[model samples]
Target: MEDTTQYFDKYEENLQREILKMCSSLGMLDGELLASEDIDFKWKEWAPEYIAVALPEVNNYPDFAIACAGYAGMAAAHWWDEDWGRHHSAEFDSLLGPRGFDDMDEHIVQKILGLTLDSVEAKQIMNILLCCAQKASTFIRHEQIEHQTVKAFHIFARTVKVMFRTGAALELKRLGYKFQKVDLNRQLPS
Candidate 1:
């Protein structure tokens, strides 16, 4: 895996920062999310690779997109643990919707948190996800002529990663968790 962040342009970096801030504003940044810091940007490296692996399981664009969402959900499941690929063929097999993604995120949140996904929060997050998806798709189509490389795919993958993590962060906020910040420049008590 590469430190793919180095490849991100200004707009992509700004978009990434805003989405993450939205997570914090919505109060989705929790221990589970923070725990992933040890990973740094590893998810950025693995998310797009999962896209190629997911080709056989999906039939169209929506399914492919949802599959990436599921990949993000699974990452949230184990604190973005080892990139063991997706559990698409494992226990999460049941969560896949026949024609679309469905409530593909149900199992992980329900099983782990014992809380249901709030419809309102889902709607808000869905809006953000859709926006991110559109940008990614646009990049893929328009980028091939210029970059002529996989940079577009990497950007799209990072979008997928942020979208799902935003969902988890929303859930964490719904569960009453908030992101805490440290004062790096605080003076110690004398």
Candidate 2:
């Protein structure tokens, strides 16, 4: 992935910064890199790449591919981890519609994530997420204007959040890290 952030306008950059801030506010950025520290601008670069890999056969399917990945990520999180409980935002649920949340424990999404990561390293995954973010940013902007809602924005946030966590888990699996089920209340600090 090349340095794609150079192509992002001031609003786009600010949007990315807002995401990092959201992560921090939600306690999701405990040990993760801040947006400013993204010196290589990997986040936005990987967003489109993720779309490509998700729907390679479709020539112009970025939106569909992104929605698919986002839905899959949401489903996979619950399937992969017993303690993984999403806050279940009503707005996000409405945006995804009835069919999207119907297949939370499905195998197809898991397979997609596995296949997507099968040929990549950590840096590659980071790039993929960044690129995915870029596409999501565009989708959010367009949807916001066309529909006058922020559901598109939440979709981007929740999707990227899941993707980042899933990517980290996949990388740890690649590094021979063992995953053990734990009680959330009984967890120890890293």
lDDT of the candidates, in the order given: 0.47, 0.40
> What would the per-residue lDDT of candidate 1 be over residues 119-190, giving only the tens digit for each residue?
564455445555545544554455453432466455555556655555444444454555577899999999
Q: What is the lDDT of candidate 1?
A: 0.47
Q: Please give the distance, in angstroms, between residue 54's alpha carbon in candidate 1 and its true position after superposition.
A: 4.7
- RMSD of candidate 1 to the true fold? 6.8
Error of 2 at 90 (Å): 35
lDDT of 2 by residue, 8-112 (tens): 343345544554454445433432432221211233443444433443422354444443443444333333342323422212232233354333213233432
Error of 1 at 162 (Å): 2.9
RMSDs, each prediction?
Answer: 6.8, 14.8
Model 1 lDDT, residue 124, Cα: 54
